[model samples]
Target chain A: MFAFFLSSGLFLGWSLGANDASNVFGTAVGSRMVKFRTAAIVCSVFVILGAVISGSGASHTLGKLGSVNAIAGAFMVAFAAAMSVYLMTLARYPVSTSQAIVGAIIGWNLFTGSRIDTNSLTKIVLTWVACPILSAVFAMIIYKLVALYIKFMKIHMFKLDSMTRYGLFFAGALGSYSLGANNIANVMGVFVPVSPFSSISFYGLFTLTSAQQLFLIGSLAIAVGVFTYSKRVMLTVGTGIFQLSPVAAFVCVVAHSIVLLLFASQGLERFLISHNIPPIPLVPVSSSQAIVGAVIGIGLLKGGRGIQWKTVAGITSGWIVTPIIAALISFISLFFLQNVFQQKTYRPVGYLITIDAAQRIRDGGVSEEKFKGLQGREFPTAVKFSNALSEYTELTREERDLIVLSAQMDEMEITRSGITGLDTNWITPEQIAALELLEGRVFDHQWQLDEALAEVSPYWRFREDDDKYNRDLRQKLSYIYRFFRYG
Target chain B: MSKGILRKQIGIEKQIDEFLDLISESGLIFKAGIGAYLNGKTDDFLRKIEQITDAEHRGDSLRRTLEERLYIQTLIPESRGDVLELLENLDSLLDQFKGAIWQFEIERPEIGPEFHEDFKEVVKYAVESVESIILSSRAFFKNIAAVADHMHKVSYWETESDKVSSNLQRAIFRRKDLSMSHRLQLRDFARQVDNIADVAEDVADRLAIYVIKRSL
Candidate 1:
């Protein structure tokens, strides 16, 4: 049953690999600087590693946007998104999995009557607009620097050709890695809420959670897609768009990779937040947009003469239309899945107003006066409860969900000592040492706590596991160290 | 048929155009050498011929480098033989310029005042013919449609050079005041000068055929 449900996510992963993977190595392979076989092999290996390691950060933000609570809902949403992308691909349009998945999630949110976190949605949309612009700026700067360096050094023709080839290979690898890290959320983010597998520990050295396992499987599907379907797409991008010099190709790939890394790197976000700088929103960005932006950047730098503005406008229209189509498809599909298939598309849960819920909402900085008339009121969904409560007091979707989750919980005593007494079997010695060092420090968010601990002991930071160990430790320590939740 | 490979082939063709430019530069130097000789500046003529020799050497090295690159890169496998043949023929045109200029520098043939204008006219026609061949060669790479016009000019200039050379040779031999050896020597110099136009016409003919093959 789980396997059947997971196939849709894998399908989406495959299509993502088929389409977006070309943006990474298309120019290199198309220009014949690197062979198609070599590019595919390198892209597959790095994409898998990236997906398994850093894929979770962007998905966490998607989860905040809307948690598709049922496995059936997740499957249908993924199917809808995949179908839209596949249909767009067949029509020879540029497909953005990011926009498709976001639209699908919104469809799910609307159908399940979940309150959409407007802040997170706004951030995602803003990044969509910013991703290509940022890539263009980065490409222009990098292209100029590389051109100046080549000019200053007066490199030989053959030597410059060899250097460009090497640079392309390196950039292609980084681009592949960034693609997997940022876009994996589009493939497996819906499944994360209803992940079927349990945490499996191997030899007490490492553990694989259900979400990571799902990501690994999706990444494999993506790798297969790259090996099989990406060749033609790569050739088109390499030669069909414009004539890209080897150096221009490298700059474009590098610029795209940097944009993906910026949006996907939780460590970078946390580093910024800790230094009193606003963090970049962790969102699944479109690799297609980034690459196009980079290409346009290089084109504009060369006086903008040869750029196919008509094609660019066409692609932009596709980007705008894809998400809306996916959303409509997901909504209609969910309706059919619920009515014809008789599947549980959403869990039927009700939230009961309790003292604990009211206190938590108050603690969240919502006014208690807003809850005056809603005492003991039973609501069918968190969205319904929050919709009523929002009339008097402004409440975000995340805070509303938190309040509803607390309201649904049975009364239980949670003491600081009791949390400390919980088993720390999975905690490493380095984490324990860092936790001790941070015994006196205060953190505004759970990630800040982990970042502070990571600063004290670098071993507390695991790059290969998506910071899972720190998250687990933070979850365990949250009982003793509670923080106010607000937008 | 692959666009990727086709684009790369265009890059190699561009390099070939640059190589033709170097050949054209050598032709111009050859013309300058003849002009200096006609002006009775023996030292200036030798110096101009030396510069023509340098241009020939540079053209030879550039042609070799281009051939090596084409062979190594295999940028245009199907047209490789035709392109190499065309380059070899074009290199021969430069060789004619170098050979004719060196002959004049070494022989230092004395010319009568009456035949000087005719000799200079032969040199002008020959140089113009080579210049037309260079334009046709460039058009072969850039604009195939323009190649025919330039090739026609090449043939017209080559014919003009032949007429001028024959008239000059007739005038030199008809001079009873000159020694037979001197007459033969002067005729040989005029024939050598006319040979440049013949070589350029041959290259232009080959280039026309190559362009037709490419367009086909």
Candidate 2:
């Protein structure tokens, strides 16, 4: 049953591969510089490697924007995104899976009444607009440099041709890797919060966590998409549209891959933050947009005579229409999946106010005096609690949600000491060593200790793969840790 | 794989060169045919004409084959139009050679003692101009920088042919030893031979333009 629910995510991954793979190797294959078979093989292998290894970074941003809590909700969100991409592709318009998935997530947020992180959402939207423009700029610069090199070097015609052929294959491989790393978030991101698999140890060599397993499955679906349906699209992009020179094609692919890598690299983002620079938001951007921008850049550099304006207009309109259609489709599908199919599209969470809850609300910097009249009242959901609290005190949505989430504690007595006292039968020796190292170091949340141990030893993590639970654990642990250390 | 495609294009380019060779070879045969007719060797003149006709036929076949290869293979799509135009213009020079030689064979113009050497000189200059143009066209596919130098020689020979044709026509009209009709026929023959150099110059001019376009 869980596997059946994952089909939608797989479908989305397949559609992503089918459409975006053309952006990577279309020109090379279309120009007859590289064989389609070789391009497809390299793309499939590298894409899977990128998805399994570095697909987590952009997914965190997607998670922040909206957390689809139920498997049914996740299915609908991915399904809506895949359908939008498919329909737009059929219409011969370049569509962005990033835009489709983001819109569908926003629709899910609206349906579930979840608190949307506007800051993260705004950053994601800004990047979507910036991604193509940046690629265009990069391509223009690169194209100019290439032209200068050709003019100055007076390279032999055959040598220039061979060099471009090799450059295209290299750029195509890099593009595939970047695509897998960045866009895998859109494919399997919704499922990240409802992953059904547990960490499975393969003879103690390495543990395949639920998130990694889900990503692996999604990568396979993408590989299937590349092999089966991307050839005709590649041909269209390569020769059917604007006939690109081999060097111009190389410039476009390289520029596109660079933009995707910049957006997807968590290491780069971390480096920037650590250096006190404004970090680049890790987001899935449309590869189609990037490549189109690159081609336009090259065309403009050559005095802009050969560009097909009508096609550009059609593509831009498709970009505008795709997200709205996806959002509408997601909203309608969730309504049916929940009401008609009787599936839990959203798990309504309840909250109860207590002495600990009041303390947490105070800790969250909210005035406890406003909650004095209803200190012991219960609310069926965080939205309900926020609404009731809003009636008494003036509070913004984020602050209200933050207060409710912090105040509404689970009844389970989870603590660092309790984590230490749990059964050690399944714990690895590395986890034991890590725990011993933290004997004197106090942790506030039990799951924080679990995460810290998991960092040291992969075996100590939770069986469930939901990023929301893991994020909640980290957030609560940080708050409690701050309270203990400061006060 | 790219090398393979390039090799195919090179093959087609080589075929074009071969076609140019056939034209130059036909020009030599046409000159020989004119020389035999001037010497009143009717049998040899007829044989040389046959040879010129055969060369023209081969040149025609080769031009057709080159056109089909270019269109079917799409070897140099960006410059195919320019290349086809160059081929057509060059091929017309061969037609001029065949047409002028056949006219000489049919008319059998009276080559007076005074104009025989001059007539042969005109034919020599015309053939030399064509040979220079062929070399220039070959240089186009080999070393573009050398094309200008070869085209310069073609221009030089064409001017010499122009001077000789004018002098020969003036001498023919000024003559009192021949009939007006015969003199008129001789002048016409001189113009036909000089037209070969004129046609070669036209083809060379087109080649220069194509080279410029390709280099850019």
What tier of docking accuracy does candidate 1 attain? incorrect
lDDT of 1 by residue, A1-487 (tens): 7778879989888888887777889878766777888899999998988887888545443332235657788888888888887776665455677678777878887787765556646755665578779888999999889877865674533345555677787788887887787678767766665677887899999887777788889899999988888876676566555567777888888888888778766677768867878777666566787787788887788778777787677667777777778778889999999999999997655566677557767877767665657778877766787777787466676666656555552222333343354334544566566666655454333444544556888765545634434554444444323212121
Clashing residue pairs in candidate 2 are: none
| Candidate 2 interface RMSD value | 5.1
Per-residue error for B136 in candidate 2, Å, reads 7.3
- First chain TM-score in every candidate? 0.73, 0.74
TM-scores for the candidates: 0.64, 0.70
Which parts of model 1 have CA positions greater than 4 angstroms off? A30-32, A35-37, A52-66, A181-216, A231-241, A262-264, A269-285, A360-369, A386-487, B1-216
Across A407-439, the per-residue lDDT of candidate 2 in tens digits comes to: 553333234664454334433456556656555
Worst 10 residues of 2 chain B by lDDT: B72-81
| Best candidate according to lDDT | 2
Candidates' DockQ values?
0.08, 0.15
CA lDDT of A171 in candidate 2?
Answer: 83
- Per-chain TM-score of chain A in candidate 2 equals 0.74
